[model samples]
Target: MADKQDKSQTKPTSLQATIAGGFAGLLCIAPLDVVKINMQLQTNRLEGLKWAKRGIVHQTKGIYKEFGARGFWRGNASAQWLYLFYGGSQFFAYDQIKRALAKTDLSSESKHFISGAVAGTFATVTTYPFDILRTRFAAQSKDRVYTSVLDGFQKMAKAEGFRGLYTGLAPSIVSILPQAGLMFVGYEALAPVFKELNLPFGAGDFLAGAVASGAAKTAVFPLDLIRKRLQVQGPARSKLAYGAIPEYKRNMFAAGRAILQNEGPRGLYRGLVIGVLKAAPTASLYFWFNARALEILVQNEIFA
Candidate 1:
């Protein structure tokens, strides 16, 4: 019975399952993500556009009232592509790296951290352009900047050159490395404990993922806000963005310093609650869907 039960579970992580899970998670979190970006990008530099300064419910209602239902999913196309590519590559890399590291004498926490960081680096660099586009689309409330994802790419490349496509790459990488590492460490540590609690179906995975994601995201959220700020700060921001925009032309540190000087420390974490809200459930769904998809695939002898 024990052997049969083991066979019924997913054998490690599968790329297809990871991608499916990420896409599912994205669908669940897109609206909150849009609002989160808007809130993060909001600054005292801007007046008369304090809509995002309110709570999540208020901001959400404002989005709907102003831009209608579709407003909640402004950058969903870019986001979907991001999850598709990043999810597959990151999980595949993590699995391979973890397996390779398994023979080493490193501690389990160290191994998970290293594997997650490396995988996150690879995936983030590969899909970074999509991330910028997603932020751009999400941050744009007053004006229609890029009509579509392809158009956004073309415009970014044409207007700002190659650098535009990777505006906040440094900060993004820094933030993601620790976030990814912590997420894996937290989830791995919490999953067994949650399972031991005799939770309902998917509850263990969901709770483990939620706690992991919430903690990991909150830890590096300031850098995340800085990344989003830098992403939308070029010509488009100067002219078309909803409110006043503070320019951060230098590196991530400079951006952080600027935010600190202008808006204080709380400014660095403007959208923290919304971010936690989005990340927790999104990660919960990701883990649950990944497990379910892997089980289905394995049962069907699909991907092995």
Candidate 2:
């Protein structure tokens, strides 16, 4: 049974599975992403956890009222690029690298963790600019910036050179390395219990992934918030009153401190609830579809 399980696991983490995961993640995560960006950028409240007041329902309604149904999908263009690349590349690296390392003397857990971190960093570094653009499109409300994806890229290049697209990349890499390592390693490790239960259609794998990813996402939520804030700092700072510190997000440590001082401890947790809700389902669907897609591909001898 253990050997069978190992074979199944090896088969499922394929390029086909990676592509399916990307599509599934995009569908599940795009709407919640917009809401999360909005909540994170909320600055009107003078006290504890302003996001506590603006629940998902409230944010959804406001976005609908202001931008209509399309509002829910504001940054989908960049999100599509981001999700496709991020989702596919992450699993691809994790799958291939781990398989290659299986010949070595490394323990399984170390292999899983290392592969996940490597894949995540490669994917993130390769496609990070798209994420910045997606966050920018999702975070802003009025006086629109960057009419389109091309325009966003052009603006970033013109304003801050190629580096403009990578505003918060350092902190993001720092945050994501551990988060990705934890999420994938934990999910892969826990997934077999579901197989033992014989959950239909790999439902148990989905559940395991959700639980693992939820935990990882929570642990890294503050870093995620800081990354988002840094991504949008340019526009926020640019519009600031004259003499205002136009680069508040220049330093992740300082930005974190500012959030603590201004918005209190809960400020670091902005959009955390929504992030968890979004992450659980998204991660579940991601793993589930990746497995299912690989199963199909294997059954057809596509990669055999």
Candidate 3:
């Protein structure tokens, strides 16, 4: 009876821990995400560290000049919902896919990759419009803004039509495949190493998760560039802009060439440093918390 009570108590504690970890992780990286998006949208002619340093400096100056330190987190309210839907869905889908794959004869790596891809695809398909709004809100200047998430959504829909909400669906979906696949593969591969080194489960999970996120982001960095451009720019500038000339069909390829021509090969990886900075800690914390939470829940039979 004592053992049963202990078990029952364990699950809730674990679940609480997991939820705590995930939210903590999200808060940690929110500022970094702001930095990353700013960097990606900068049109200045700086390069390498000069470009990076300028972006950071400019962002800091803008934040201080506008909303002080708080200005940097401008879209955070809407972002909370964005992350909740996107992050929650992705994590949930990942677990579900992984569990289903566990019954198969596939290798752990194969399972992880497939699970990640499926999770990404599922999450994107379900919550893409919110994603578009989040980007718009994040990319907005302090002077020009949407009053709220619903305001942004309604405005975009009214102005651009229903399809505006899915402006960058093609590159966004394609980008998810490799990004998610690499993230899971990297996480699964590195987890054992940390375990072998005798680190605690939470610490090991975070470290592995960070590495996986970095790897995944690096792999799909180019796709992200394309997607962001399409999302931020209106129909005329996007690759999705279709017409009698089939101009939109060629816009994607043309955009790739323009990036290379104007910004050089390195332009394809704009904001990569910020991406790594953000992804590593975010993923690490998310997985660490998630695993710990699940273990606790299962032990208490909350998940059984």
- Which one wins on lDDT? 1
Q: What lDDT tens digits, residue by residue, belong to model 2 across residues 1-304?
A: 8855665555554666566656655555778888887777665441343322567887778777767888778778988888888888787787788888889999888888888888888889989999988987775455667779998898878877877788888778888888889988888889988779998877987898899889989998888887877887664445421112224657889888887887788878878898999888888988887777776666555655
TM-score of 3: 0.81
Error of 3 at 84 (Å): 1.2
What is the C-alpha local distance difference test score of each model?
A: 0.83, 0.77, 0.68
Residue 10 in candidate 1, Cα distance off native in Å: 6.8
Q: TM-scores, in order shown?
A: 0.93, 0.87, 0.81
State the lDDT of candidate 3 residue by residue for 1-304, as single tens digits.
Answer: 8886676555333234435434543544667777776666544332322323455666557545645677567567767776666666776677678778879999988999998898888878878887776666556654554678788777778877888888778888888988888888888899888878788545888889888888888888887876766666654232111111112232556666767777678877778888788888888877786676666656656635
User: What lDDT score goes with residue 38 in model 3?
Assistant: 60
Better model by TM-score, 1 or 3? 1
In model 2, where do residues sit more than 4 Å from their true spots?
1-25, 44-53, 235-246
* CA error at residue 294 for candidate 1, angstroms: 1.6
Residue lDDT tens for model 1, 172-244: 9999999999998888889899989988776898899999999999999999999998898677877545756
